[model samples]
Target: MAAVETKALNGVKLKKKEHRNAYATMMYMGTPRDYEFYVATRVLIKSLVKLQVDADLVVIASLDVPLRWVRALEEEDGAKVVRVENINPYTGQQKRFKLTLNKLYAWSLVDYERVVMLDADNLFLQKTDVLFQCGQFCAVFINPCIFHTGLFVLQPSQEVFKDMIHSLETGKENPDGADQGFIGAYFPDLLDQPIFHPPLNGSNLDGQYRLPLGYQMDASYYYLRLRWRVPCGPNSVITFPGALWLKPWYWWSWPVLPLGIEWHETRRQTVGYAAEMPVVIIQSIIFLGIIVMTHVARPAISKLYYKNSDKTTSMMQTAIKFIEIWSILAAYVVPFAIIPRTIHPLVGWGLYFLGSIALSSVAINSFMLPAIQVFVPLIGIFGSLLVMAYPWYNNGVVRALAVFGYAFCYAPVAWGSVVKLLARLHVSVEREQFFPKLTESSPPSGVNKLC
Candidate 1:
């Protein structure tokens, strides 16, 4: 009987250890950013696993999140996925963040003693297992007064979860109507709490405490020193809380936010970009075919251009000019539309540049235009992207102002390019080379007959 009792006690202890803690993030569907966040979340989970943190990885995903994504999270990335219904306490909230309240489901995970809830934007630099030892609630105060919810520690409790749901139903006063605002209101006193310092003996603490800024180092801090210098606690994680478009997962965000490269490096080591490579390769092949065809068939294309001496010549010129302008616009827009939305930033930009060049070739070859004159729009676009992504701006307002300033300066240059192209088109029309010269023996073609 004594031996049996001891065995039973050991089994109970094992069960408790199995569910001691978890590092969790939430996912939902609706926005175009869904796939991007999925990729980011996978990287975050894999990074934690790479650190070999002493916790289970969990993803609190909404029902709308695709089944394949959930399976990948569980099988490929080694995370436990819990499907939940999306909570929308703030119906009037913007559609982008409408489902973010699903994060509240973290409190419902009573199987775990503690959970370190994270945003997918987090870049883990080191093991953060010590966060589990924090109290009932702990969060980094990245802002001077308000704690950021991007990375926070919480003890799972069904009672607390129920109370939160009730508060949401009761219409709690949430300034932003998203999880951050709601959670902030829920734990109003976190601002005044003492900073958490894990017990040396590995025992857990109980009440709310503030986590040091080191745990949630804002990426903007690196812009100042180009390195981290949070002297208080372990600089374990980095969070991007600024403009949504500048998130590290985006290819364009790198070099601008140099930290983005680090995120992609982690992704490369883990996920390996297998999903989007085929599409990229196929796109490259098609664009190459387009370039080759346009160049090889330039003579045939030139033959189709005909000189018009009648009054309709003005209308023909107007139509040709419209086509020229539209072609230029499409050259820029089509690449962005066709590329896979969730592709790695580097590949996405590469494909965009290639597509632009190939499409521009058609216009350049068809019109017999100067190559440099035709590519001015592409150069201007590249310049605009650089101006918008300049990272050293002190604030968003300054960034906006800088972009506006660039547009103000470049408007005249763009106009000059258009003017030059039109003048060249007029010269080509008069020369009769682009508009093929009609010999007296040649019969009128269908276009000429119609005119």
Candidate 2:
């Protein structure tokens, strides 16, 4: 009886130890990007589960993160939430990264034997279960001298957490006033550490080690070669540490960063786009209706523009030209407002193109403008997008110069299109034949009937 009881106790203890490691990410609120990052965090967690990683998925959310988002992370994404108070040790940080210091709470996860802290922008290419076997403090040196905190293995200790908090209170030497700089300052010697290689027998390591660049492959590297060729370690994860706007979740980043499609692909397979699909469907319907209605009612709309007097004709022409130009401008601006901010990039761009065509149709039909001439702005916008998205530019300087060259080449064509549009407007106004000639005998000389 005594031996059986001891065995049962040991079984319970072993079971408890099973969940001692977690793959962790942080979340905080009070930014316009809060929801974007929340969705990104969910995708990251779901991707980890999809990869069949052996460790628990954890979200170290701040107190202000919405309860609904927390529940979704817990129930839908299969992540364990650890709510921590937002740590604002640096009061002078930029608003964009103000809450990033909250990531320091990953060090307080004492229940986990090892935690692989991550940023929401990380895209895991495969299971990196071996990272759990690394030492108390292991990070990839994506830069030559700085170890990235985007993904790092850390052993949770109350003493360490307290020391870090105390250091914050006392003003640690943080250059950027964000978690990355503070943590980099905290572990300044990680660059000198030996590279971590998981033991074949799967035993855990004991001290800090430098993870190879393959683990935190920077997305910019792919822009140069259009592929990844990290020669060391397993190519486990990719991190987008560049401009905030180009983060993988944003739709505009798709063709600009081709790998963004991969992120959205994982999202589609896992959490899916149910949250934003309704908006996309409605927008599509509206655009299609505009295209059809404008085509069908072209004659009726054009008849309203004709006038008899020269002053009225000149004013009408000016008004029509202004409306056409503004309509073209609205075609470019309206789509950015209507498309769901976090919808898949392909869908967003599709809606944008469709919206541009649909809106441009109004101008095309009302003024009897040529379709090709009216769409010059749309064509120019597409050409500019292509120029900006070109992947082979040797550097940003070259990319900027290429864009300048394209704009320089395109300016004359744009001006010529405008000239053609003005000339076309003159002919249409003079002819007054955009619709069948008004049968009412021109409303008597010198008298104007404004429609």
Candidate 3:
């Protein structure tokens, strides 16, 4: 086990438990670049733990770990560190993906009946007492689950995990490559109304907008952020899911927190600054090129742009323009380099072959699904066995065997997709061939200009 990042948390929960069930996430890698996110989540979560909510809140991970190991603060007084030694990523194989699935496999052994899984950034304001009241799987999330990772609850029954793994294997033969497709497959009933921030009162600030912006999906992946443009007052107690997981060099000035919201800034100093660098000094600048307001830095900078009437709005507009440009540029790049051979076989035969097998796998299982008592754990066992098997393979001779199995399983429907990828990647481009079927009628007026 590794050290728990105050930011990431995971687990499933159900309603009606005397004490809340929980799990904290810890990543194995520790790089210096992770500092900003570190400081942000630390200040945020520490506040919640400090609240001393009732029940034994155990911070499970690395019993006694040292990061830079500042001797004076080497140990925290109240936080308890623990390491889980029995976890495995892949159950039945020696491969990495298998190891990954191995850990999620632990859900089968959880002690609690009702479990509420939340991300670490989810700071509970009022005791989430109502969470334990519901009977089915429910989530209390800030509206829009785009990039949100916290506040979802589930009643783990092993069957859900099993179906997810099966879906993962099915996707390997389809468009998606793994079980993530199956994550919420069995829990569709719980997907309708996740818990939220704004209570839809219809008259509140920003008038019923939710918090966090983690709901938008990008191609095959889920993006980060839960709410945007949400308005909030000062000193408000709300846990923060990651708002901008994209890189800073993206040029666009995306929202750090919501626009009108006064997010509490942590008091800690940022990572680095050099005294000799002029950009490092901000407190002294006034206006124009001068450090004092004589020509440079009033309010912030009035004299330099004093005569420009639209300066304030220009700054804001410029910021918005960069974001729009970045978004446009990002659209052109291949977000995912899908394997050249696709799964839909009309364009190619391999995918159809594989997809046929996948359909059969499901068809065989469907007969069981109609009978709940048998299908539930059967899905779990079925999925877990796949993870242990580590069936997916790479592109070598061994991988070729896996691919053959993959093609045999899904190619009937997916071969066309594979052919499209090959054509796009390897075929030569001719102007007419690339731009076929173009007939442009010259428009007479501005009204005829259609985008």
Q: How close is every model to the real structure, measured as TM-score?
A: 0.76, 0.76, 0.35
- Candidate 2 lDDT by residue in tens digits, 3-119: 112222111121133476888898988887888999899889888888888888888777778899988888888788876666775666688888787777777777778788999
Candidate 3 Cα outliers beyond 4 Å, as residue runs: 1-20, 23-33, 55-109, 113-115, 140-148, 156-182, 192-230, 233-451
What's the lDDT for all of these models?
Answer: 0.73, 0.72, 0.31
Selected candidate, larger TM-score, 2 vs 3? 2
- Candidate 3 has an lDDT of 0.31
Q: What TM-score does candidate 3 reach? A: 0.35
For model 1, residues 88-126, the per-residue Cα lDDT tens digits are 857677777888887887877777787889999997877
In candidate 3 the C-alpha lDDT for residue 375 amounts to 25
Q: Model 1: how large is the Cα RMSD against the reference?
A: 9.3
